[model samples]
Target: MIKLISKTALLSVFVAFSMMKSQSVKEILNQEGSFRKDTIFSIKSDSKETYLPVTIIKGKEKGSVFTIVAGIHGYEYPPIVAVQELLNEIRPENIKGSLIIIPIANVESFQKRTPFINPLDGKNLNTAFPGSSNGTPTDQIAHLITKEIIPNSTIFLDIHGGDASEDLLPFVCYYNRKDIPENTKKAHDLSLKSGIQYVVSYSYTLTPTEPAKYAFKEATQQGITALSIEAGKLGTVQKDNVDLIKTAVYNMLENSGNSVKRKSKMVNQKSIVLLNQQDYIRVPEDGIFYSELKSGDKVKKNQILGYITDKFGNKKHDIVSQTNGIILYKVGTPPVNKGETLFCIGYNE
Candidate 1:
């Protein structure tokens, strides 16, 4: 196939190749001072792109990198607002490390005030971590976060709160992976330093098909210190909750030796571990639910936490607690479907 090509044709081929390479490398963030960048991530199955708004604050002096993520559930507004405040309040020149903040992880859901799974893929972004490049929309976002963002961080914070349809007590969680002793201790320490009232040692009971795919879990699996903090309530952006979240970020930064004025002290906090399926109570059938219990309330085993009454006003099921623990979260809305989570309880072994 020895054919003579024109100089114009050769130039066109080179330009096309260069453009492809440039698109592949797509710069996420590159600056030494405070800046904001917006990116349209082309990771959706329906060929739609997700808007990832990022805030970067690079210190004048070189130090460790910390990444903070919020709005994984989209409808959780307090953590999202807290991240936005961080972008505005932090002085990059005064710090020693870089801070990368993603105020809204799921823009589509956030815009619509949707809860849980992505509308396009029907996948929970939290459970779709370590995702595939060719998978669903949520999966692709997870893959990008795991592959690109998490690897660049020495420590990562996955901040969250109750979605628009949920009500929950504030708590902070870190994965308890005994296999990695060094990172495990650091994660535990970070949890205590997070300025939250309750610290939960969370470990997944993985099956053959479902491994650990949560944001903090997958990040910690890669040897990065990670923690998850839950604050706010019922999809509302309360200032007190936002301030609590903001304190955690600054606390972690100070603990990690960032050039902050005050270091965070380890607060005396209650801790719990989730090791059984009974800890999570799910709706048994489709009905309108009425709950007498709220988050942080202590309940006894076999106690009736709430009752589900059908549309006709007949009680269909009695929501009961299977473990002697404190209520961690509950559905805020009365309408619920079968198998939907109604309440999460935290218990000690």
Candidate 2:
């Protein structure tokens, strides 16, 4: 009898261990109503030493498929926090379509607290889109996202921020294509309703080196709605901004059935300027930059925006505006250089 009892006890222990393992994995996966939550896939380093996680939540109802991607640059923390908060609040019972939230796209960079390039492959994941299956570490991840994730999405929201090196105003960027489709417009409008302070319609000619250029362009080609949201400063998480982003996501989900409301009127007037472009000005030479102007400050042509000086106490350059417009951005650091962008001036043509 003692031998029989021992065997039964061992069998019970085995069953308990199995149950615990099943529950642990199940916690990572969930399904409710029409919504299905799955990790989908993961990207690992060449040696398989590191892996980045990606999650997808599909709503059962036949509505729309929106993908929210954050942490493209690991140092940008606001988007990550915002996405996590969103995931916690969203319910499958209420959702009509699918929501794929990849809260941390670059886990390695994030873990190392780096910006832009993945430290492993020295490649910017954002730029290497529609990537090759046999490409480098970053490229393979990009390929996975573009080929496996993006194609299945009907709408895409790429969350971003300036970086640990700089501070940027919050804004939404959309391609200014004359033939933009209705779905694209819907996405843009919904983004604006998220209460972002600025909505900037940008053209391809404006940003020549944007890493997400291919992703945005591809979304446009597929007739899928895609927009980018720029939030708090890089590397740090701002609670207020995260709250704002979360609020925006909730607003988007709630308002998807209704027509997106545009709070700001479309202004033909330029309020922000990109340097080396249409009407923006560049620093003439290297020196100590002293700016009398702040962001949003209006300036006239030839107005002394700032001055640059050499280390030897010699005034090397005088930064001036080329047109009458508002200042969109200015250097926050002390040292300034020639040909380096000093300020952005927005002017009415």
Candidate 3:
């Protein structure tokens, strides 16, 4: 009463079904395997095509997706180098999920050693987030990040260092939100996992321009855990400083999920949550600055932090602090202009 097909016929049918399923998986879902692919996200025009390199690494098994980005300012060489070296060190077989690393976010700025703004669009890439597709090059790149990268990521890690003229001690920042308690806790835990010296929390403050436009800000708002970590000083890259950032990143990757496993050697570090932006000490006039205080120095209210003198060394003005705090960052260069920021102080207690 039953019909049995020939072995050859049955084998052919099985092969056909297997091929169909493979094609469907390839077309519909993200491919599962361990491999490295270099992709270019392009913003096209009539004359040229500006492209940003995105490195994609997918592990054998599916888990959480973590994205690490650096080189937004170009001159922040420490994070850039650390991310670059990650390509060689990270083994896909040992990872449980995906890893996307954009070593140089601003190619134009990185090529020209420009600080802050992209030379092509004359825009700060950091501030131009959740960007416009039809806008400048920087904005387009930001758009790609918001649209293409952040959406696919479970964690958005923004790495930075002191620019060409900034000197700072190492620190980590996590967004704080009272309304979204879970997100706030995740972000805080991410910061603490980095094992950095200082940790700052950003809360909501009504202002003319909102902070919701930033890349990390938008990421956190969308229920993703985001962190911005910083180290190094000035534009020059030091091997030790680069290693410090690299270690912190490895720590994050190891603890994020089943990405990798290693011995836990993280030290217990103290953190301070910055409630407001009242600790900035800006220059009063154009002058040459001489400061005995550097980043990490503790100060009291009304204490003279530094002295600024005229070119001829005749007129001198003492730069004083308005609150008791620890110096977060100081100007690396001696020359300063009126209204320029000289130092930023963090809450002491």
The residue pairs in collision within model 1 are none
| lDDT of residue 248 for candidate 3 | 78
Q: Could you estimate the TM-score for every candidate?
A: 0.84, 0.73, 0.84
Identify the runs in model 2 with alpha carbons over 4 angstroms from their true place.
Answer: 1-33, 36-40, 44-50, 204-214, 258-301, 307-315, 323-331, 334-349
**TM accuracy, model 1:** 0.84
How large is the C-alpha RMSD of every model relative to the true structure? 7.6, 8.9, 10.8
Which 10 consecutive residues of model 3 have the lowest summed lDDT?
19-28
Alpha-carbon lDDT, every model: 0.75, 0.63, 0.76
Across 6-114, the per-residue lDDT of candidate 1 in tens digits comes to: 8455544433322112222124334535434433334435554454555666676777878899988998999999888877777766677676677888877888778
Compute the lDDT for candidate 3: 0.76
Q: Clashing residue pairs, candidate 2?
A: 34-60, 35-60, 163-234, 285-338, 286-338, 287-309, 288-309
Query: 1-349, model 2: which lDDT tens digit per residue?
Result: 4544573354444333231132322343244455545442434344533343556555556666677888888888998888877777666655666677788888778888887778888888777775666667677667666665666677777888756643456666666554655765786677666656566555543232333535655565555677778777736888977876776666666566411322223334335333222354676776777765665566888878777788887877777777886655556567665675667554434
Instruction: Evaluate model 3: give its TM-score.
Output: 0.84
